[model samples]
Target chain A: MKQRTEERMDQDLAFLLRYENIAWYEDGVVKILDRRIYPIRVEHVICKTYAEVAEAIRQMVTQSEGPYIAAAMGMVLAVQEVKDRTKETILAQSDEAAYALSHARPTTSRQMQAVVNDARQVIRDALAEGCFGQALVEAVHAYALHYLNEKYQRYTRIGQRMEELLPQRATILTQCFPGTIVGTMLRACRQKGKEVILYCAETRPYFQGARLTASVACDMGADVTVISDNMPAYVLMNKDVDVFLSASDVITRDGHVINKIGTFQIALAARYSNVPYYVTGTPDPQHRDTSQIVIEERDPRLVTESMGQKITMEGVKGYYPAFDITPPEFVSGVVTEKGVLSPYELDRYFDE
Target chain B: MKQRTEERMDQDLAFLLRYENIAWYEDGVVKILDRRIYPIRVEHVICKTYAEVAEAIRQMVTQSEGPYIAAAMGMVLAVQEVKDRTKETILAQSDEAAYALSHARPTTSRQMQAVVNDARQVIRDALAEGCFGQALVEAVHAYALHYLNEKYQRYTRIGQRMEELLPQRATILTQCFPGTIVGTMLRACRQKGKEVILYCAETRPYFQGARLTASVACDMGADVTVISDNMPAYVLMNKDVDVFLSASDVITRDGHVINKIGTFQIALAARYSNVPYYVTGTPDPQHRDTSQIVIEERDPRLVTESMGQKITMEGVKGYYPAFDITPPEFVSGVVTEKGVLSPYELDRYFDE
Candidate 1:
């Protein structure tokens, strides 16, 4: 009771040591729980095909890039079951997976591209080896698992790097779902016995703060304060949140990091508040070109709909830019699976 | 409803002629039945002082340019009851009313400013007469009532111009409250034996469209259909909304219109959809330059707070930008009490 900071540090360290490997199989069946109804309702869906996957993605069930990438891998694997695991099947699956993933979350391009790249590699290896049946299936399975694990480790490394960027008891404001990286990083901080506090923005239209990230932080027991997106100026003025970490769907070669729709405003607020702001993600080759990225237009109802009884309609139309691009200048750093790099260092990974 | 087009024409004409003078006064203490708990708990508050008025205005109990202007007038009148109606009182009342009014809704500036203008005018008239006591009281009352009446007329004229522009049954998409103008216009059209249909946009965060404007339209018995703000593009692309009419907060001398945060995007959408769009409001005189129009910000929690069982803190923050400016280029015309002025004509009114 006397040592609140030490208590929090211990709790976070415990979460870091814990292994949460359920490997919930995607199976082309959209099995991710609908995040829109999280905490209130945990509903899992099975998306059988790429089309269904697209619908789920658009609907925001499996919204995070990690799960989205994982789902694409599952769908690619499902394609093998339907047809012979030929080179054509593998290549076609990669292409289809990429498209499906891109459409799932239009703002971020890396997840889809990353998963498809792994799938294509499996195809290339299989074609060169002249393998079929069990051998081909085994190779695909290994590749899928490898990509997912690689993503996790990249997040872990980024998390470690994030810890180094800030001090032991740094107050942090996080926007959007940073996913495995966030958990791993918080776990890392807890392990290091750091007294870090996360002031999370409850990303509006979708309260990812209260619904997803907050719940996760609560589970891991972090000193987390959930605030609305608009209150960043207040937080910066009142609370001394030392650092800001956000997750991105795409980090363009030009270093235009497209994350959640409200991230740019938060970054602007942070920069104004003199808080360091950073975006964390594994940048893919496809994400190197910002022009190639197509910003997804969300359903206007997402902006118009509210939680109410009798299902009242809000008569005013709303514009939901699913993600906003933060120019490299606003971003303090870009954390990837490889390492945490400054905005200027974006080119090194882009060329990778 | 035989001869559907004729019936619609009859309804539209009635909106212009018969419905302009429906007056609604607060029954002492009024509760803005929470939009989230509709058809369930009807929450009402007895608005006693300027603070109550401010709270109501900030919380959106008295929303829309008409009711907002009316509410501001009421707030000034209520504040005057306690203090001497001097220049300080007038400025303080206007300042507080404008502050609260600005926070009540975002993207509309005319209502608050209009009320402030009315308040300022009363103060000036009060000073000139060298009258204190009952005459001063009467002057305040007269000015407040006059502003409300003036707003009603301006809206009615706008509605009339809208009918002339569209002719047939018009489907109108409204953002927030346009006050009695919209309601009166619908009534006017019906009175003229014209038919018109209204489509309401569920203005998000506050649901001004679904809760306020829809109720007003429905009560007036206008043929109204409600749609989500998100679905406007689809609705405009598919359905036939002849013209789009949104209430603006600030209309600059250069004729830039500011409205709810999302109105700009909708204007862009309307332009793309090839539907004529109009921004309605009276020209503010105090601020000769649009830049001089003070933009008000509100609590941010409102955006995150869902309409349901109360959770989290007693009040999450709510970000309410009382009004946004819309540039003249996207606006087809400006609707005011004087007349429906072409966008180019806005300068004539501001020239004074």
Candidate 2:
């Protein structure tokens, strides 16, 4: 019965919201939908080896939650590489692949690492029960698929919670791509006859908000408009923005939200403007606060140039810090699969 | 003696800061150094007629104070166009040219209009003094040149005031191109042997901060770094930004500042971080406050594409408001030719 409900929800998602479009594994190949040039070009980067998948993540072919999903599938590729070998060899190789995948991007890596580690433990348990060879490969593949399914279901529940929390009619200001949760929330809103207007900040250096978030919102049939990264404060001041909603790459147990580089500024503006800022994601039990968070500084070339074309002068220097930490004070609430909880009340998310 | 001092000051400016390089009138043609593709290519868009000059300003071939200077020279072209006609026809044609140049871009148009109108009055005065034809053309040209000299001298004084206001060694955060004032300030800082670090927000859509501001600062031999527009708030939080300084397109008598779209957000962040935010410009005696300011919505194509390459997907809508208003409460002070005055004390700027 639960499977039937999830299948029905799957049909309601936009093209990009579908798990297969974000990433998929088929016949010894892990295919990741290249989000860097997505919507403009629907192409995928094919990876036959785990290292290739890790490189794709480093190159940002897939971003946000796509990395986490792709990393899990990468572990499957690791097992498939040595499927004919001993169970001990497969286990050792898969652990190495998991380490490589976890370190792909610093800010979002911890969760991906945890997912891969859990899969490794599952393999260890299955091996003790006599699972080996092709059966071992099948076991890892099934584990990865199951993990992907659980992620989708969790996001769907969070989206439903978001739908309930959002007003019947709302104008939301969001920064960067928030993964499939936005599309799922839009779908949920449609079912309940709620109206949502989205203003996406065109995340600079990489136009994720423009190409990914806005495209997904458009696919979900929401009234969406893309604004440059700097326009959010102006929009909040002039436009009727009901809420400032974004996805948190990491939500610390003590309630800080680490997200894309521009999120902190928007949160400041929202707080000053009397608008509540809510971040969507499950809390990280490992991190007690923001001290453990590493703000990744990507290649400066990404800022100085766009699509291999120089936007500024040749000699000029550019700084590109990929993520920023938003303190708990600025974040009004965290929308998790459990429900909408005050930033201070995030401990409830981990109670189970 | 005054002319010699002005000439010596002229030598200290960056290549882009020189008046002739900004916009020059020679042999009946007004040539404007195109800032849109400047630093990358030192090219000028030649304008043979007043209409062509006005069109260039509208097209943003020249921006900020470039249009004001170009508009003044544009009036010279207007007078040159009617050099063979009667004095009455010359005066009438110049008036029409003044009106067209004044309305080139909304926020900056009022000043451009005022400069052209002042040139028109000079033409009328010259005609009354029995000047005609070629003599009339020379009179308008002389007036425009004198106006240009006065502007440079005023900005130099303002730059000195800024140098006095800034700390001995400081890191300043600025947004967009603030015309020649930034170059003048850098020169003054060098003279005083004060160390300075500049973080420029690469104002999106046009990239004026990256292409124009950073280039000028580099020429002036200052330590400069270009950051994406979204990164300013993050920098303010993490980096030691001693001051937030920017150029205001319009400063009303009530002390509100209207500048490039991203300025307001930076001001908010600076204020939240407990840093003073200062804007440089003379106050408009004609207007009372932000109510009279016109924030321009530029072409969406400029936002969706960078250097003719599509940054976002097709069929996506982009919002591009060229400027935003910063309330008096957020502005630390207004740096004018007279001195650095509190936003509330802007009335002193018009005491003359």
How well does each candidate reproduce the native contacts, as fnat? 0.05, 0.64
Off by over 4 Å in 1: A1-23, A26-30, A47-55, A72-111, A123-139, A307-318, A337-339, A350-352, B1-23, B26-60, B63-147, B150-304, B309-352
In candidate 1, clashing pairs total 80
Q: Which tens-of-lDDT digit does each residue in A1-352 have in candidate 2?
A: 1333435345678777676776677888999999988877889899999999999999999998898889888988888898788877988898899899999888877888898898788788878888877787778777777778888788889889889888989899989998888988898899899999999998887888988998888887888889988899999988889889899889999889989998999999998889999899978988888888889999988888766767666566788999988889998889988889988988888786
Q: Tell me the lDDT of model 2 at B29.
A: 89
In order, the TM-score of chain B in each prediction is: 0.73, 0.97
Candidate 2 segments whose C-alpha is farther than 4 A from its true place: A1-9, B1-9
- For residues B1-352, write the lDDT of model 2, one tens digit per residue: 1343445346688888887787789877888998998887899999999999999999999887888889889999998998889877887898899999999888777777789989989988988999888888888888877888888888889888889888899798889998888988998899999998989898887889988998888887888889988899999988889999999888999988989998989999999889899889988987787777778999987887776777665567778999998899999889988888888987877776
Question: How high is the CA lDDT of each candidate model?
Answer: 0.59, 0.86
Docking quality band of candidate 1, CAPRI definitions: incorrect
Q: Candidate 2: which docking quality band?
A: medium
lDDT of 1 by residue, B216-300 (tens): 6766666666554434544555567777888765666667776665565556557756888877775555445566666556554
DockQ of all candidate complexes: 0.09, 0.70
